[model samples]
Target: MSEEEFRDFDEELSEGDPEEGEGEVEVVEQELTKELAGECLSLLSRTGNGLSHAYVRLDLKNRKLTDIAAIQSFVHVRYVDVSGNYLEDISPLGELPQLLTLHADNNRLATINLKELQYLQVASFAQNKLTTTEGLSQPMLDRLNLSSNQITELSGLTETQLPCLTSLDLHGNKLTSTIGIHLPSLQKLYLASNTLTKLEGLEGLRQLTTLHVRENQITTLDGFAPSMEGLQYLNLRGNAVEVLSELTKLQCLPFLRGLVLAECPLCELDEYRVEVLILLRGLERLDKDEYTEDERADAEELSKQRAEEEAPENETVEHT
Candidate 1:
């Protein structure tokens, strides 16, 4: 950026904050003025019609802005970055009918009720004070990041609201269960570092490939259904899973290749690795370690022996 892009602080700010304190920084109320807009706007491009010129990217990061009512006039902008600011209200951006991408992390936004942008694809509102997913509705959004927020429940989110969503990051939230999420098209889901005790209502997400629920209170694998056939990577590390039977529920995931269970209470068992491989023979990696040839062969033998032992009991019951 050129030197002209930076604003010159007044004499009072250059010296120090005299009344506030020696090290404290005061937050002055600010707005997105027309002059500031002209200074910040940079990426020039042709419109979708290819007839008119317009600035498509408006980056105003770390401007400490509280309001942005002036952005409504920039109707042609497609990408915006207003992160690291003191903004608590951004309803002014709802006017950008052509916006496709937005990054507004680390803000003071308590509620987000923007008008549905049909072309929006990528959105990140991480590290905010959002309590729910009530107002986040983007029809064409592909990737969304709401990590490190105060979201307790996905009350208003559904597959119908985010039909095209593929990747969702909701880690570091306050979610206790996975009930309200109904996104069937999602492939990647990050729900680590939450207060979830059990996994449920995720059978609808048949297309999910990666599921990260690390560092939670989950003690068993009761919620996994046989319909999750596309799951490849399952991260359940740093949980309280101690029983060996909890992994039987994951045998339905035919495509599962990676499974993490380190730091769990069961990892301390002498035959933890061998037992897991015996139950889920399809796993190629476990706890960040790839299985060796000998390990796979030994587990295969143990699995056949275990299954044969159970076959006699089943046969006796059927004969009766």
Candidate 2:
């Protein structure tokens, strides 16, 4: 054979034949396409299934969910988490009849219709462009996290609709004051990092356990309710509260444990300190950021004593 022909034959053998490589590449491409199509079809079928519980998460993040009509088929879905998507309007989610939890945070949702979610228990709409908080009717909701929104007024959540709401987070919002929020079952409230100048509309919640109102313009605790008998943790740090005497109403809360009062303009008043000691008799953690070494030692001693008291008892009996 000629040298050129032999060289071509050797190249063909070294490259494993072009036809074989082409066939292998085609098979791989076809398999990948089939797998992609199967996943899409499975998602579509799941949207069509009207089951009571559905979880379509961990895969749809950052994906554009433009097909709103696909959600109408899943009418029986109780919990739906469509967070981290590029969804514009979530009005189609209202079509679900049994939706209990809607976690649509970190989305481009400009508006939300809360009237459709009657069975919703936990709704997290954080990081949205919501200007107002209107049209919510779920009375059995337990937690509502609406932080990082543009809400100016809180008049939308009335007393009757949020009767069973336990935790509410409105941090980093534009709330100037706390009005029209008559939550009776509220246990923990997070109103930190807002534009609140005064604290109001939290008196009726006798079941309050934790109250976080730090980094606000609150100058007084005038509107603090004495009926909050169940409050345990209170974080009022970085406020303009001059007098700590207003916290005297907390004496009613026998379970008060932790109190954070750092950065507030407070003086060492003997009577007020005595009152705080009386009110927080059951307190295990008190952070003022100004505790001297001696004071910290005393606190540590008290904590050790309390721990000993809480420890299980060991008994010894002597026989006659």
Candidate 3:
């Protein structure tokens, strides 16, 4: 689909459905069975005037549905999952001002704008035809999953302030760099299976704990900064890491507990496991196996012996 179709809207958030789409109006009024409507209407608050907030929480997942224009009547819907559908236009949902969490994965939607959603917290737009993140500017968002898309850049996200954002999943995109996107409170970041050649933009995230950058073109550890001291779990399984000494940068991360280097070239070293255990002294797990206390002690002893064996050559050079 063309990117021009994803234009930003300036529509004001309001109550009540639009006065058009008589076909959808019939779907909501006639197609709904009496038993299903009664069960769903029970979730609404009945007033002296009429029924209020119909279908506030709707789950129409994998129902083989094609048209969701009927959702315009759910004015007070706070959470909705319309996954696995053939919907191409969710513009009808922009009327629901109280929307919070939305799960719209596995659809054919090429564009959607929820900038008016003030209280939105979590959003998942994965497995779609979206080429950009144009209309996702909610300030209260905490988690976002936009994996398995054709997204090329993170341009639209830099305009908003996401102070409470903790986790971001951008795996299986065409991202080449993460230079402008900055979230101070971000803790977990997943950028696996992308085209990243370096790890430069993550220097400012001091609260980050988990980082998964596997299956990329990263070949060195020089890009990692000291601000990543709080990182505990790291997965760099299938990167271009070739040298064992490159892992020395990990010494700055004191809280690191688990590390994965399965398919990397460094895992083929003669003393791979022992050298890694010695470098990252307090690691409890390496690759897929958990290390025991005795193994750690043995690795420490071997490291000391190796250091001692290389000491006399330095003394002879100093005397000469």
How many clashing residue pairs appear in each of the predictions shown? Answer: 0, 0, 0
Query: What is the C-alpha local distance difference test score of candidate 3?
Result: 0.71
Worst 10 residues of 3 by lDDT: 1-10
Q: Between candidates 2 and 3, which one is better according to lDDT?
A: 3
Give the alpha-carbon lDDT of every model. 0.84, 0.63, 0.71
| lDDT of candidate 2 over 28-122, digit per residue (tens) | 11111223322432222244345533433213343445334456565645666666555567777778776777887776555676464666789
Q: What does candidate 3's lDDT look like per residue over 108-204, in tens digits? A: 6677655456777888877777777667666878898887777777755542456677878887778888665677778878878888877777777
TM-score of each: 0.87, 0.67, 0.79
lDDT at 215, model 1: 87
Model 2 residue runs over 4 Å out of place are 1-59, 267-280, 288-320
Q: Give the per-residue Cα lDDT of candidate 2 at 206.
A: 83
Flag regions of model 1 displaced more than 4 Å: 1-26, 307-320
What are the per-residue Cα lDDT tens digits for candidate 1 across 1-320?
12221112111111111222356567799988988987888789999899989999999998988899999998999999998888888888889989999998888777886889979999988877888988877899999988888889887678778999999989888999998888889988888888999999899998998888888999989888877898988888889999998898998899888888888998988878898998898888888777899998899888889899999999999999
Which pairs clash in model 3?
A: none
C-alpha root-mean-square deviation, candidate 3: 10.4
| lDDT assessment of candidate 1 | 0.84
